[model samples]
Target: MGWHYTPYGLPYIVSGLVALPVAVAIWKRRSMPGALPLSIFMFAMVEWSLGNALEMFRTDLAGKTFWASVEWIGTVIIPVAWLAVAIQFSGRDEWLSRRNVALLLVVPATILVLMWTNDLHGLMRHNVRLDTSGPFSVITKDYGPAFWAYVVYAYTLLFIGSTMMMRSLFGRSRLYSGQAVMFAIGVVVPWVSNALYISGNSPVPRLDITPIAFTVSGLATSIGLLRYRLMDIVPIAWATVAGGMRSGVIVVDSQDRVVDVNPAAARITGWSAALAVGQPVVEMLRPWPAAADACREHEIAANGKGARQSEVVQEVAGGDRSGDRSYEFRFSPLLTARGRVVGRLVVIDDITERKRVRDQLVTQQRALAAMEERERLARDLHDSLGQVLGFLNVQAQAAREQLSRGKTSLADGYLETIVTVAQDAYEEVRENIRTMKGVLPADWRFAPTLERLARRFERSYGIQTDLAIPDEIRDGVLGRAAEVQVLRIIQEAMTNARRHGGARHIQVSFAVAAEGVEVVVKDDGSGFEIKGLGGGNGRVREQDGVRADAGFGLGIMRERAEQVGGRLEVRSAPGMGTQVRVRVPLRESEEKAQGRDAHEDSGR
Candidate 1:
């Protein structure tokens, strides 16, 4: 409010230059937490420094006191601004409501009112005089109760604000530690300097050097702004999100040291998230192998490009149920603007429920397939055997009546017809029994079982069957249900070759390929013409619901494959040999589905 020319104003000018630019820098990023408050604090410093410089250089007593009062505008408000900065920076902004801010303003407003009207009460300045103190005109003031009260209020606010910033500096991420240090120096310099001056311990008598201290504060905070981008954000933001997340999150530096861990991660590793930080994640999770691998950032850090994957089961505590929740840990490179890998961020998602629901769905599908299979078999019997049995009953009754009328030849003929019908029904029943093979392979891991099946077939039917299943393909592609379906498809193909194709040598070979798990069943037997069968292009499509009346029809075999989620292909010619190739795509590991398959097949 008051200005005077003075040589001591150079320090104030320098302080203004420093504080103003820092203020603008922070103001530009005012949307960030603590930025606006920091800007306000910087502005207050500019006002106080410039006003004090003017007050100290002025020789006239009235002008000295008036300009000193002008300095109150910055002095009264500095603490409030600092407190606001601390509150917002420390993630405690919810306490800073409109009412609280209005209340905070009241103290500074009252202090300003008292300072301007001090001439009436003499309570603010008690006694004031302009004196030549160390070659500079300084305003010397006798102590007043109001001025002491203001000192206590200002220091109290400073203490509270400093505590907030220090708490985060010590407890939060180390990345922002430098910024915190600079910020503390900036705030503390003015506090100590003012306390000394107000306590009558200033280096120069009758001169308040508090404004000069703002120069140092401004310089310290300016360094923080330029070097650390202070007030833009704090490392606590990362920890805040990581801490509150339901999914486990673990962050590691480039050196693979654990930098941050969420509570969920601690729950998984059985180590405290707070204490585990700054330790090696590998060391912390050594007791649990699966979880250790999940938290390990070494490989991802080495890769530098990040990783892409689906899901994997990471057991927490329990067996394969609750305590043993599934987690899909995704590893990504934490990069800067220049694409530098500073660290790796691992996001652990709990997928236990997803796996459980998927297993339940598969189980339901299998149940539905079983029910459909039963219905189809029942319908076949009703349509053929049921009618045959009914006809036999009628012929038997007719034969009995013919015999009762003394027509022995007619009764004998009816009996013969009954015998003929019974024989036809017997053949149809045999055919049905021959076509149905037990529900493929029961287990998802079917290499051993398939080998056993081949051996059994060779022994029973006098056919030389060789199984050439590779190791990788055995436990690779397709889920449990699909594997069972694929096995059934191959089983039916083998049966068709023996009964219809009259195959001599049957070879079952499978290999893991890029496309998927490829299975081939080749028979050097009397292969039938695929074109002549309804499977060829000329015939009605299976989608059209046209039933092929032929030997060993593939309608049911194709349906079973589709039901279990697989693709089936039957390639054959007149005598070139038949190749039943099945390519089942790979499925992401679903432990729940695999376990359910095992449970269902335990009886088999």
Candidate 2:
């Protein structure tokens, strides 16, 4: 096998060399969509060009024919590979299944076999001979029906692939449009060269310039790879990811013009994507003034020096015919490799359901607080008013009995006591009503409220009330719920001192302990035995004028203390004064905070 070199074949060698690096570059990114097929396409171009260059250097007919057959190997693969790249790049990868790809290769594979066995059948080429052309010896042949059939098949695939790339020119970003334009040129240049060669219209006879034409195609792809980052950022993947998202996505350029809007964004903004592109972003987002203002603010911040990519999230409310809806808008700046701001990306997420659930939880909490308030009111009425009414009944019967026995002076005394007791009950009823109405103001101070309660107790019961609270205790803060419970406990203690123990004087003092504030209420009165009060039920044997079950107020006071994360203790013995102590933690527990919130709700 002898070979001859000519200057005419150098361009093919250069074309083959130029395509080598492009093929390797694309192969490196083969994991991306369309990359594998595009790399295969470039590899096929390399084989065709180099094989044709070798065919031009071969002097003998057999050597030239062998290289031409080798060139046919790449020739058959190019069209099918190009079609596959188009399908994958256009986001139609589902169509490139194994069975479908195999079907696509059927005609190319058959043509190659027929060309190899054409000596016997004359179906691929007939009357093949070596033509010593202007600058080199090249093989020339008359194509047969089979060769024409392959030509038609190859052209059909090229046309389809080119058409798909052309469609990407409109309604796409400048990056994608530039990539599509380069691909379209790559596909069309080779097609036109092949057509000229087939029609015998080539400038040089018997030399197919189709392989040389591929140099232009390879250069176009290289430009796309470098300038537009075709393999790195595929537009079809962007479309599939952003278009199918439930959240709205909008992209704007540096000038605040709408570069792209996904379908979800179009629905959210009530603007069509086709019409929204190239419009001013401020005008497009006019319906949501807050969102528009956020975009403007982000753009201004992004333009500053050393500005890095950051996301700003804010909740926005919009009203419609049904009701108000909430949405969370997330704004992020789009930056270039040089850290220059290029645009902004906004994502809108609907949060109406979340807001609705939150409001429903608040409503349920208020209802629960109302129920708790009613229960507290019931306990207060039983502890104070019920006991007063019972005393009035007993005193009225006593006065009637004295009058019937002709003890006029004793009856008159009983009447005077009844009048005083009636006035006290009236004041007690008014105080209970004020408590039910949540009379504790928002800025209510613990010491002042306690002092006022002591004064009222002194006036109602004719008992000398002494308060010995420290400066720290007076200045300390307590949650409204805990404060209310503490005051009620003190009131109950005072009442027990007067009624049950027949106390004359009551002393209330506070001391700061290790864990919290400790309150002590002492009375100089006829104290009952502390025995039989172990079970929190407040059951005790009868002592003095108090009934066996008259210790119910003690049980109620213990419950109120526990509700506010506190503890209560009572000490008493016969002929000794009664002392009630309560310890309340300084820091509110989770349970206590919830109770405070409930108390506020009831107040509202």
Candidate 3:
């Protein structure tokens, strides 16, 4: 069981065998994004192969020459491996702009020149010596200057690469950072130990310790790589995602000290992430009096509640002056593997747009209530006033008839004139009431309402209107609100056809699908300049900003349709009649049928 015993080879041999299959599996699976780690693994396998070869050659002449060649050939491999690992780990490969690509190509060439000339000769040995009683059958010079440069170059790449890797891995599942650290130590420690041995530093009695250390580092790294997926998964990397979001996120221990904050958290909270790392979470976030104090106390009191607590919307003052920012502070406990809560996660999302939408909804609701009131008053006057006028006309007619039947000498001129005036006034009032009712129909079913509207237009404006609607739509488009919006939009289009487009005929067609809605309205009438009309998305306003009579109808239809998350489309031709089509989404259950149809279509 001594270091030189064959049993000592057990670990290296086992690790090498195990690593080969795992590396192959990883290569075959190809789940990871970068190709460099696979390259590093290839290098490791080569080194392992050489080590095994050297061991076998210990008692043979040809084996000795092979080992000598193997030992000196690092001139080509080490620098290449270092450069590859550095580029991959730095995450600069993906962003290799022209400028960076030039650097990438050049840096290695410089390193190679230094290696061959022994200028960077500090890292690789120019000579080898034979010795007895050492771990190998031989030993080499300390080669201080050469060794120092070698150590410096290798370690500098490692240290810089690892720091960047850890930063990229942070806040990911603890598995990520932990694995990265493990891999880094696994590689660096052994390499450093070997350097120390080369310098004649006494620790393990012989250079044979390099293999043992290498075996340990390899085992540790292999374990971590398998467990965490290391460079194997295609993702933004937890550290990169957490660092790049616009919201503030904080992780706090039970003691309330801040354990983590991303760059976004720092920018929003006005605290440098590095400086805020160990400060109290509450102090860093510092919500107003009640919220800040409550967070600390409640977090401790709740202990391990699996609930996510949220705050009432609060205005965050002082930042960009776009408007007041309202934040919804969400608090969820961070739990350990065993389900015990270790800490809490705080996420602050800017809900300013949500607040603005809510305010707009309130204003619209008030306007709707006022419109309803006006409609109610208009209806009341129409019904009551029309009946009163009819009764008065009947009475005047009766009086006039009675006076005519009586003697002509008894007829009063003033009475006759009064009767005539009252009859004319009653007729005018009746006509006004009819006009006030406008043109809405009593029935509102889809097909029936459409038929009624078309007939009314034919009779009133002497225009032929044709509506082509299928009996049953494969995709259902008629939610209550959507139905109303569709009807109103049609009504408006018909009005426009008569008043503006001067259409002779109209056709409306609708097609609906599970994913979305489509409506086409085509009209042949006196078409105006379409460009001058502005796109449909623009607000239709009156000359005085009160909304044009035509514009009002369009606005109401658009608003109602948008409320139900549907859309309205209007199409017209200059002299041709207009056709309008309306379509809306079917529910998820219907999507299955639609998908089947789609699949069948694709098959065909």
Give all candidate RMSDs, comma-separated.
14.0, 11.8, 12.2
Model 2: ten consecutive residues of lowest lDDT: 232-241
Residue range 229-319, candidate 1, lDDT tens digits: 5543344346345477887777766556677787887776566756777677677656556666755434543553333222233544432
Residue 281's C-alpha lDDT in candidate 2? 80
- Best candidate, lDDT-wise? 2
Error in Å for residue 469 of model 3: 14
Query: How accurate locally is residue 575 in candidate 1, as Cα lDDT from 0 to 100?
Result: 71
TM-scores of all predicted structures: 0.53, 0.56, 0.51
lDDT of 3 by residue, 1-604 (tens): 0123344345446645665665565456443333435445444654654465455336543444345445444323444344444445444555534575465445445554554555334454445444556554544434545455555665665556545655655544442456667766766766677778767684845434554455455455555545544543312323233656787777665556665676767766777766776587778655444446557555755563434342333345334422366665666665432233435666767778887898899999999867864764465355434544564566557667767798444346535644654554454355335435542344435566566666655643567777777555322346444555566677667766666566777666666555755656566766443333344543443432122344444545566667666665554444444444555554443456669999997874
Clashes of 1: 1
lDDT of each: 0.68, 0.76, 0.54
Clashing pairs in 1: 318-323
Q: Candidate 1, TM-score vs. the true structure?
A: 0.53
Question: Candidate 1 vs candidate 3: which has greater TM-score?
Answer: 1
- Candidate number that wins on lDDT, 1 or 3: 1
Model 2 lDDT, full chain set:
0.76
